[model samples]
Target: MKLYKTFTSIIAFLLLTSCSVFEKNRSEQNELAYMKNIEDVAIEVSKKQYVNLLQPGDRLIILVSAQDQDVVKVFNQNYSATEQFRESSVPRGNIISNSQPINGPTYIIDGDGFIDFPVLGKIEAAGMSLDHLKQYITSSLKRYIKEPYVQARITNYRITVLGEVRNPGQFTIADGTATVLNAIGMAGDLTIYGKRDDILIVRNVNGLISKERIDLTDAGFIDSPYYFLKQGDIIYVTPNKTQERLAKRDPNSALYISIASIVVTIIALIVRK
Candidate 1:
């Protein structure tokens, strides 16, 4: 009976220690909005909204159309040429004809923040908005074709989500605009081990790279400039304190477990004796 009691005590102690180890690995259970007594309050959006400006290394798709396809054909020849160039770069296979229906041609902004347009030449498009660029191009085309219509959009607008999210990768923004929440949703939301109160956003605006740390626990970030994500924005959901502690834990945890088991067995043997 004494031996039986000693064995039961050893097992209980082992179970308690194992439970403590698991508690350390458990994730934080803090709610997303940690604000106390939060009520529905009408918050006015900031007047200074975020607008994506043209920047170097941006890919743009500019299409010109009018009542007559023949009249505007010259203005759109670059689109066909760009497609042909892309096709030629690919491996020898079933090559697509340049006459094939494609969305539009992509214009890559050069390092100097300029796209070498066919007829427009080197026009400054670095800081111009899409609407502003379209108006500028329309005015320039007026000299050649009457009633010229210009449509411009960024083709390669992408956002990257990293760190403790369920899915971490680069996602393309089809509509050319998306909010930070949209990015988080695309990444399958943050994991339980993610630091909801502290998030990092890296942005590049008009040749200037900026980093901003946002707190998801507060509703105030909804009105911040970082609310609206820009092209090539990177959102990193940092790991919570619990996750960080787990990461910093000893690499020889298995060895420690083996040593503990040996010690427990030795104690049991002595108790049996």
Candidate 2:
């Protein structure tokens, strides 16, 4: 009867400890869920704003079309030749000028943040919308190219992903607009232990740098102002507590568990005796 009592006591003690551990883990999981819910609310508030205008150091690909091939050729030749020159260091000057018609010119923004158009002289393009810049360029092209159609786009708008992602690096968006989620997907998505509730976005708007937090686990993120990422945006994902704890633990520390088991066994033996 005494032996039976001892066995029951041991079992009861273990059950209590096991329940405590289980409850602790459950509570932790619940806390994570609650935090994620709050994040969803923040993301829902972010999506109402449109993307800001372009900035300096942005690469632009502008296309111009006109009724006269000769007029269009002047613009097109510059871009075509520039592309060729960029692809290879070869001298584009030797290329036959009349071999290909010029459609539009391609020029990087100078340090002064200006692009020099053939007939428009120097026009301020940085911070201007594609439509507004196109209108200005089209008006000027009328003096040279009849009924000119102009289109402009930022070609090198890229986002950088860092910390806690499967892959972190600069990702280029072919389209002018890329969402925060899209940028994450390009970086191979967040890791399992990534803190989805604490994603950070660093944006430079009108020469001012702004930092924002986003939560990707909730549907509300679809409507965030930070939802659509602009050029030169940086995203940083933080690691959660679980990941940090695992990182700090030494895999070779099996001795600690062994010591704990031995101490528990000694105490049990004393109680039985």
Candidate 3:
């Protein structure tokens, strides 16, 4: 009877702690363990500095504002005060929005990393940050339009999240304002079976692809250079061992286990009787 009771308790405990991966290692699961020894001395950790660099096949939403709307109009659908300018931009593969004079069509960078601008001709834009590109455009437009104000941003700043998350999908990082935690938050955080101590981040750095494991439970992740999720980053959260074991169990095996448990219960009852 004591042996049976012990067996039952073990099963109950296993069932209760099935997918609780974070509970297994409480000390390593801390998000900010490095802060424990800090006294009053101010310290600064190097956080992820997100800088968006333009690349080929990237689409940019470019809008130029000026004191004289007519000078800037040539860059938009109404630039020519007619459909001629709009027709010219269509062959260039720009997403046109002409109703508003200030907003220009979305420009796609060519394979050679060049974009065609009104009066400016083809300009090399790839490898330039959004701010640098904006400054370049503003400086160039100053030659024609007086005090030209340029606003440039990437049309597609997106990343993908997958595996062991409550919600896994592709999400856009509007204005490059999202972080690693923010992306996880968008995915409704990690599942109970997720290994929070080792989350994977896959990205294309320069010409090469890089894969890194980041811990969500560590505050030191804030100091990592890759903390800020870049465009096209893939965040993959691997499941803990408990989930793996659960996944490895087949339906047939589960059915057989249930049948065996029932048979054992029946035999024990018969023996008691």
Candidate 4:
């Protein structure tokens, strides 16, 4: 009878301990899922399209390519030799120095938001798209170089991510097409406690600063105008109270839970024996 009682007690104890551990894990998973849902909402809210306009102090890389060697030479001679030019050209097509090469003509916007091209003179580029800039340059080049192909791109299209992200810093987009969700992905997504509904997007347009709050929970974010990120845009993720509380309360919750689980299992085994 004593042996039987001991066996039944052990079984009950073991069952209770197993249930406790299972419940703890389940609670943790649920909390994690809820936090993830918040992050998803923020990402969804940032899916709106955005078009970037040029501003002063913007750097542009303009490349003019052509099939005719003489035409290419004339075009090249028009602009000052950039760093890329000094590095790429070799004698007899054999590389002499593998050092860093100079690149295309660096177009710096003057105080009037205009760049002085060799043959094009001073042209206003601010508030113009890449295509617009290309067309303007192509029209001017036609007067001098025949069959000239012009390509223009913004050399500095960067966005900043801050708050509740794994990594916070400035990131440059090579293609000039960056979205808010894209910035979050670059920052390693948001932490578990980050509030998805109250994300902040800061934008600077024509020297005026504006701020907007975004909620990521709704699927309608795709139609929002802020969906695309512009140069110098900033994305900030705020943390929820629950996450802050969890962080503040019981700094050793994970450790305590682990120790309690082990202790419970040992007690059950002893009782069984």
Q: Which of the numbered candidates is closest to the native, going by highest TM-score?
A: 4
lDDT of 3 by residue, 1-273 (tens): 665665555555544454353355443344323224233212433323567678787777777888888878786532222211221111111122232333355777898999998788898998888788889988988888899988765656677889988888887543544567777777777877788777899998656899889776556666666677777899999887666766887736546555655665555555545
* Candidate 1 regions with alpha-carbon error over 4 angstroms: 1-7, 18-27, 31-48, 80-102, 111-113, 120-122, 138-149, 204-209, 250-273
Please, what is the whole-model Cα lDDT of each candidate in the order they appear? 0.71, 0.66, 0.66, 0.67
Number of the candidate with higher TM-score, 3 or 4: 4
Off by over 4 Å in 3: 1-48, 77-103, 205-207, 223-225, 249-273
Per-residue lDDT over 11-53 for candidate 4, one digit per residue giving the tens place of the 0 to 100 score = 5665676577567655644544333455655675555335566
The order by descending TM-score is 4, 1, 3, 2
Model 3 gets an lDDT of 0.66
Mark the 10 consecutive residues where model 2 has the least summed lDDT: 85-94
Q: Per-residue lDDT of 126-176 in model 1, one digit per residue for the tens?
A: 888777888999999998887998766665777899999888888765335
Better of 1 and 2 by lDDT: 1
Cα lDDT for residue 164, candidate 1 = 92
Cα RMSD, each candidate? 7.7, 9.9, 8.7, 8.5
- Can you give the lDDT of residue 254 in candidate 3? 47
What order do candidates take by lDDT, descending? 1, 4, 2, 3
Number of residue pairs clashing in candidate 1, backbone atoms closer than 3 angstroms, sequence gap of 3 or more or interchain:
0
